[model samples]
Target: MTEPTDKVDEQPLDEYLKGGSSVSRQYRQLPGADVPPSLDRLVLRQAEEAVKRPSRPAWMRWTAPLAVAASAVLVVSIVLETGLRDETTVSAMQEKREAAEAPIETRMIEEPASEPSANAPAADSAAAELVMPVPPPPKIEVPPPASASEMPMTAVQRRAPPPPVAAPAPAPLEEQVAKAEERDNAAFVADVARQKSALEAAARERELSASQRAMRGEQAGVAGPRDTVETPEPKAVLSYSRPISASAVVTSADSMAKLEKTYTDPEAWLKDIRQLRKDNKPEEADRQWKLFVAAFPNYEVAENDTAREANK
Candidate 1:
């Protein structure tokens, strides 16, 4: 029984030494994992009867683990050395500061800001070294790390303002003056044209009056030569009227009372004058027109009609 158990244990080694039994078959069946070419060649050489190669040394089996441990030890040593160096530097600086301040107790300097006496002793000069207090460590207030929802928002994009527009320059002084003078000249010409039109209208009115008077058996000629001619008094005329939106025209009692000797309506008096003219009665038409003027002193027709009749 002992012999069989010994054989069972050694069987796997023997099988490996020989072609490596069932495990090799199962390894070959892994879907995409290919056996390395070098490993396959080594296995082929081992399987052949004539091929002879030295087995790997025992120490070679521990090579990978030893390399890994060496790397880990190196990294750990570097980290520890860095920490020790930092601590040593801080302690050295503290000791140096204490050594510098310890000498201040031996001296009796009252004013720290004032200069020392010019004849001070060498020992006092050496003892009166300037001492500055160590600055406090900066308070690095590290805020808690924000969660996904509390993260700061992106910077807002600002729109640039519109660019300033250039304004047009004003006209030159000389050009402005020329334009004003041209405008004045044009206005003067328009005034002259208006006066000429008024004179032509007056001439036409005089001709019509002469013809009408001639038909009514009245003389149609100028009164006398220029030196002896007397210009008649100018008749008054008014044309102001109420706007269309106003209520009916309202006459005062005094105005109605003043119109005693003439027809109430200027229209009726004008019609009566026209009828007398048709009957070839110039004197009667003239008389009625005079009464019409007295009745409605503000009639615009009074000036034109009176001018026509007076010239005739």
Candidate 2:
């Protein structure tokens, strides 16, 4: 059996070499001098056929895999680099945001007042750099914003004081009435005084005339002058007596008593004789003179004896 099996295998090999087998065992083997020309020719034909046909190039065979590997490495490197950069960026942004939200410290500044020069400019940048930092606009006490209802009303201020109010003028009619009243009062007082003086003068004139007429009549009876030849003396008229009513006159009790004591009717007649003599009216003064003659008869006797001698 072993010998038959070996012989069977050798038969297959022989058939493969003869190209008469249904199956063949193909393998690369070294070329030999004993190799058939037909087989060599077949092998050469196969090699020529393979050479004539197109093939995948060496660079093409691995290009897809190498491209995939390179893309993965780039993705991983970019992810790592992005992760590293994000930490610092996020930290810087956060610090900037905090700083922006922080409140600023308040400060106050006062600018000095100065006399402006005509030639100097109002503001200078060089001067501003040298100037102490203006801390801030004087931190105006910024009171919290007021509600609409609490807003203060603004009133316009007057540049000058309001004009003075004028006093009211007097009415024309009232002014005229005051002036007229002043004039009327003065005229009334003057008229009163003039009337008093005139009345006093008339009383004195009447008293003198009455004494002269009385003396003239007595002298005319003694001389027997013709009435037509001699001018007649004017008659006298006595004026007012003392007022009877107390209401009509102002008088003192002493003055009233003195008036009553001073003159009886006969004494008044003697006063008339002396008053007539003082008036230089001897002719019509006899009636007043007769009272003195009756009072002193011896003086009348001397007067009659002198008259008798004159008649003789």
Candidate 3:
């Protein structure tokens, strides 16, 4: 049995190597072993039909997704539009409500004013009385008075003369005149003193100017001209006073010039005003602020930059 099995396997291998065997030929020739002619024709026809048929457009692949996306976008837009419309409607309704309530509120406020109060009756009665016309006074007719000649004389004609009028008591004219004379004397004395002081100041100023001129001339190596006529020193009519120095006058003038400085640039002016405030010069700051307003009327200023005191 082992020998027969080996022989069978060897026989098939030998026939396969030899190209083919009768059984292989018989299998190949079987009714449905190879594809039928009709099946080949049908397959070829199907292949031809597939090739001839037009392919779907490339864009068709995205149609469903694009449609879905468009639907989603349209839905979102509609929702947003609806929301906006709702918001607008709500706002309009709110405005309408406010407008409708405004008149009611006004009426409520006006009703109290229109209605009569506790004192209305008394005020109305007083007004009515004032408005009413006044009645005319009754006329009284009397017979004409008898003439003076016909009138009876009760007493004799002798009447004592009226007492002589006394003159008004004299005012304290002498005392008043003396007081006025004293006041005038004092005023004259003060005036004289003031004039003396002024003259002294002028003399000092002239002396300073002369000295400055002399110094300048000396520096330049030239002789300064001297006045041929000398002004006499003014006599101290009332009292002598110390004269102001040239340096003091110069310093005061410098300060006055600084205070009177004008600012053309608004920013610089504002900066200086702030600096004044920082330096604790509120009065100067306020004054400068007023000047700034006058200089630039259209310039806007901050509230805190105004004067520290409300009254200012």
What overall lDDT goes with each candidate model? 0.37, 0.34, 0.41
> Against the true structure, whose TM-score is highest?
3
lDDT (C-alpha) at residue 230 in model 1: 15
Per residue, candidate 2 scores C-alpha lDDT tens digits across 1-312 of 257675467766776889845553233333434888899999999999999999978999799999999999999988876765565455433432222112110000111111111111322322233233221111111222133222221111111122243114335333443543333222222322232233334434444544554556544223321231122111100111111111111223332233222221222333444455546666546654554455333321212221212212
Candidate 3 lowest-lDDT run of ten: 136-145
Give model 2's TM-score versus the native structure. Answer: 0.17
Model 2 root mean square deviation, Cα atoms: 56.0
Please give the distance, in angstroms, between residue 300's alpha carbon in candidate 1 and its true position after superposition: 99
Model 1 lDDT per residue over 132-167, tens place:
121111110111213323222211100111123312
Candidate 1 structure, TM-score to reference: 0.22
What is the descending TM-score order?
Answer: 3, 1, 2
Better of 1 and 3 by TM-score: 3
